[model samples]
Target chain A: MSEKTLTYEQINDELLGMLERPHPSYFLLLLGFLLALGLFVLSLAIQIDVGIGYSGISHPIGWGVYITNFVFWIGIGHAGTLISAVFYLTRAPWRTAIYRGAEAMTVFAVMTAGLFPLLHTGRPWLAYWLIPYPNQRMLWVNFKSPLVWDVFAVSTYLTVSVLFFMIGLIPDIAIMRDDAILKGKKLKALIFTPLSFFWRGTNHQWLHYMRAYLIYAAIATPLVFSVHSIVSWDFAMATLPGWHTTIFAPYFVAGAIFSGLAMVMTVLIPMRVVFGLEKYITDHVVQSVCRVILFTSIIVGYAYFSEFFIGWYSGDVFERSIFYFRPFGAMKEWTLLGDQSIGFPQVAFFLMVFCNVIAPIPLWRWKIRNNIMAVWIICGLINVGMWFERFNIVGSSLQRDFLPSAWGSYWPTIIEFGITVGSFGFFFTLFTLFSKSLPAMAIMEMKESAHPPMRKETHG
Target chain B: MGKFSGVWASFEYLDETTEAIEKIRKQGKQPQVLSPCPRHEIDHALGEPQTRLPFISLIFGGLGCLTGYSFPAWTASDWVLPVSGKPIVAIPPFTIIGFELTILFTAIFTLAGMIGLIVIDTFRNPLPKGAKKYPRFQRDRFGVVVSCEPSQTKEFEELLKAHGAEEVHVENS
Candidate 1:
C-alpha cells in the first residue's frame, strides 16, 4: 500500500472539528469555578465575623482544615512538575502527552495553594511582614519558625513552578497562535509572543529550551518534595508527641504525591471522557498512572503503620498514651476525632489504605485496565482516600497531644468545607479553559518521540 | 564524517558531551546524540568542561542559607522578639528557606545557562510553510539530523531511515 499523505489542512480540519463542539466539561468547570469563588467569598466573610475563632480549630488544634487544605493543594501541585521536568530529564517516553497539563496544574495549584495561607491569616495585610527584606519597621522574618519556613518554601515553590511553566508554554503558545482555527486565538497567542522572547522554532532554540526544561524539572521536583515535607515538619518538629517523627518528611511527601496522583486521575478521567480524547489518552496511560497511585499508596500505608508501630515501641509515655487513646487504643479521654469515640480517623487511616493502596490492585489485571467502570470507581476512591489522609494527619494528630491542657478539637465549619470544595471547582475551571486554548498534548514532544518502524500512515 | 579523538559516547542526559569526544577516536565517523533536554551532559558536550555553577551558586545558596536562617533569627531575637523565646536562626530553622533559595537559584541558573549555552532562538521544525501541503510530521515522525561528510550523507541517511526515520533531508551548510 502507498503512503497516505495528510495535508496541514487535513490535520487542522481534524483538530478544528474536535474543538467545534462545545465541551460539556467546560460547562461543568464553569459552574464549579463560580461556586468555588462563591465559597471563597463566603468563607472569608465568615472568618471576618467569627474572628478566625469561629470554627472548630482552637488552641492545640490551631491548624485545622485551612492548613490541611494548604497542604492538600500543595500536594496537588506536585505531579505536574514531576510529569514535566523530572520525566523530561529522565527521557521517559510517556511524558509527552501529559506533561503540558501537569505543568499547568503545577502553576494553578501553587496559585490556589497560595490563597489558603493568605486566607488563614489573621491580618492578611501583615503577610508582607514575612518578606525577607528590611522594612520601614526593620522587621526580619522569623527564621526558627515553621510558619516562616512555610512562607519561604511555598513562595519559592510557587515562583519556580510559575517560571518553569511559563518557559515551557512558550513554544506551545506560538503553535496555537498560528492555527487559523484559534480565530482571535492567534491574537491571544501573539499577546504572549513577546513574553516568549522571539521563539522562532529553530533547532538551536529547541536544544536550549529542552535543556532548560529538563534542568528546571529536575531541580523543581526535589524542591516540591522538600517544601511539602517542611510543611509537614512544621508540626512534626513541634514536640507534639504524635507529630515528632523522622519519617514525616518522606511520609508526608508520599501522601502528597499519592493525593496528587489521585487528584490528577480524578481530573483526567473525566477530562478524557468529556473531551472525547479516548484516542489520545489511551487505557495504557491510565494503567501507568494507576501503577504510580499503587506505588505511592503503599508508601503511605507503610508510613501509617510505622507511625503506630514506632510510637508503641518507643516507650515514650506521651507518645504511647496519645497513640493509644486518640484513635487506636480507643481511650475516651483521648479519643477526639469523629463520630466514632474510638474515633473514625483511625478508620480513615484504613480507608486511606483502601482507596489509595488496596483498591488500585485490581488495575494490575489486564481485564480491569480496559474496564472504564472499574477505573472510575477506583478514581473516586482515590480522591476520597487522599482527602481522608489529610483529615487524619491534620485532625488526628491535633485531637490529643503533649498535654491535655493544650489539646483542642476541630471539624470543618460549613464555610471552610464549602471553600475546600470550591478549590476543586477552580482547579477544574482553570484546567478546562487551558485545555481549550492549548494543545491538550505536547505536540512537539509527541512528534519527536521516535519509535521503531517509522512510516507515514502508521499512526491511528 | 566528523572526526573524533578518544573514548567518546553520549547516551544519558547528564553525561557531559566531552565523553562523546573521547569516543571519536574509535570510529570512522564522529558521533553526536540529541538528548531530550539540556543537562550537565553539556559539560561533556563541551569537552570535559568544568563549569563553576556549583562553587559559585553554593556560595549563593550558603548566603541564602545565612539569610533564610538568620533573617528569621535576627527578627525574633533582636527585633520583634516573641513571648515564646523561640531560638533565633536555628539550623533546622532555615532548612526550607535554605532549600528554597538553593533550589530557586539552582533552577534560575540552570534555566539561564540553558538559554545562554544552547542559544535556542528560531525553531527548525514545525508544521512547515507548505504544511497546508504536508502533514506527516504531525501524526508521527521523528527526524534525527546526523552531521556527517558529503560522501557519507546517503549512507547515514539510509541507516537512520532503516532505524525508523521516515524521511531524511540533508543539506550542506
Candidate 2:
C-alpha cells in the first residue's frame, strides 16, 4: 500500500470512504466520551452552584488543577500549527498525510484550553471583563499584565488556527461534494455544496487560493511560537523565584512542542489504524514525528537541568529553596482524607522527569522508534509527564513561595479531578465527531505529492 | 443549447492536458484549465499574474499593529492608571498585543481578500455550461474549456481530440 501506487481515484475513495458510514465501535467510543462529558458537565454545575471554594485552590496555591489543565491543553495545541504551518513552509511531504488531524486536534485542544481561565474565574459569566471594552467605570485591562496577554494570545490563536484549518479544507470539501453528487446522495451534496464554497478547481480560483494559503502559513508560523511564549510569560513575568525566569519562554515552548507531538501521536496512531490509512500515514511519517518528539524531549530535559543549575549557581536563596522544595519538599500533615500523606510535589517532580525525559530516551533507537505500539505507549507517558510538568511548575512553585508560614500543600478536590477528566471527555468527543464528519487527511495535498497519471507517450 | 458557444475537453493525463492547453493557446484562444489540484504546469500554461493577496494582508496587518499599540496607549493615558512604577504606556508590554494583532489582522483580511477575489472572478468569468457534468474534473480529470463562436466550435473540438482529449463536448448558441 505504498503511496506511490495510489492514483487520485484510489486516494479519493479510500479517504472519502471514511465519511460514508461508521462502524459500531465508533459509536461506542463516542458514547464513552459523551458519558465522560456528562461527568464534566456535572462537575462544572457543582462548582458553579457550591462556589469556587469547593475546589482545593486555597490561599497560596491559588492556581491548581484548573490552571495546570489550561497550560497542558494549550501546550497540546502547539503541535497542530507546528505540523501544519511550520512543516508546510518547510515543504515536508510527510506532513500532507497527518497534518489535518493535527490541525483538528489543535482547534479542539484550544477550545478545551480556553475553558480553564473561564473556570478559574470563579464567576465565569463575567469573563468578558478581561476585554478592553469601554464601560461606565472607565476601566481598561492592564496591558502590562501577562494575564491580559494570555486572553489576547489564546483568542487570536484559536481564531487563526480555525481559519487556517478551514481554508485548507476547501479543495478537499469540493472533492467530497463531487463524490456525493456522484453517489446521488442529494442530502450530502446539498450540505457540501456551500461548505465547498462552490469551488470549481478553475485556475483563476487556485491562483489566489494558493497565495492566500501560503500567507496564512507564513503568519501562523510566528503565531505558533508567540502563543506559547506568551503563555509562559504568564509565569515568567511574575517575580516568584521558580516562576520568574527568562528561560521559561523557550523552555515552555520546547516542552509545549514536546507534549504536543506526543499528543498528535496519541491520536494519529489509533486513527491511522481505524481508518485503514496505512499507505498514507506510513511508518516513515511516524518515525519522523518521533524524531521531533525526541529532539524536543532533549530540550525539555535540558531546560529542567538548566533550571536547577541556575538556581544553584545564581546564589538566590529563594530560587535555590524552591528548586529544592520541588523534589524534596515536606508534605503537609493533612491530606484529602485528613490523614498523613506522602510528598505529592516530590512525586510529581519525579514523575514529570521520568515521563518527559527518561521515557522518550528509548526513541533514540531506530528499532524502538519504528515500533508503533512502543511509540504509542511512550507518547502516552509523555502526555502524563507533560501534565505533571505543568502541575509541578504551577503547584510546587506556589506551595512554598516566600515565607515558611505561606507554605501549604495543594491537593485537587474530587470536583477538580472530575472536571479534569471531563476536559478529556470534551476533547475526545469533539475529535471523534470530527473524524467521521470531515476529511481527516488532506486529500488534494496527497494527490499533489503522488505521481500524477501520465500517458505512455506525450502528444506533440 | 441556445446562446452557448464553447468547447469543453477532458484529459486523463496531466501532460496531455497541458499540451491541449498549449495547443488551444497557440490558436489565439485563452482557454480556462481546470484541475483536481494546483499544478505548476497548468499555471505556466495559463500565465496569470501573481495574486495580490500578500498586499492586502500587509496593508491590513500594518493597520492592526498600529491600532494594537495605540489603542492600549490611549486607553492607559486616558485612564492614567500606573502599576509597578511602569510608564503610563509601556511599549515593551504593548508590543505583545501588537504582535498578536498583526497576525490576527493579516489572517482575517487575507482570507477576505481571497474570497473577495474569488467572488469577483466567479462573477466575471463563470464556468462554462455543462462544466458540472464533468465532475471528474473535481476528482481525477483535467479540463480545457474555451469560449468561441459557433462556427469555430467544430474546429476546436477536433483540435481537442487530436491532442488526446478523452471526452469533448460542444456548447452551441
Q: DockQ of every model listed?
A: 0.18, 0.82
Alpha-carbon runs more than 4 Å astray in model 2: A331-342, A457-460, B1-4
- Report the lDDT tens digits of candidate 1 across residue range B31-141: 433332223333344344333334434555566656655555556667655456655445665666667777877666666665554442212122222221222222322
Per-residue lDDT for A371-426 in model 1, tens only?
77787788778778777777777777777776666655566777777778878766
Please name the candidate that would achieve the greatest DockQ relative to the true structure.
2
- Model 1's DockQ score: 0.18
| TM-score result, candidate 2 | 0.96
- Measured with C-alpha atoms, the lDDT of residue A432 in candidate 2 is 96
Report every candidate's CA lDDT.
0.63, 0.90
- Candidate 2 per-residue lDDT over residues A1-460, each given as its tens digit: 6676689999988899889789999999999999999999999999988889999999998999999999999999999999999999999888888999999999999999999999899999999999999899888888888999999999999999999999999999999999989889889889999999989999888999999989999999999999999999999988998999999999989999999999999999999888888899999999999999999999999999999999999999889888987886643432333324447788899999999999999999999999999999999999999999999999988887777766777889999999999999999999999999999999998888877888864432
Off by over 4 Å in 1: A1-21, A181-192, A326-347, A450-460, B1-90, B109-173
CAPRI quality level assigned to candidate 2 from its DockQ score: high
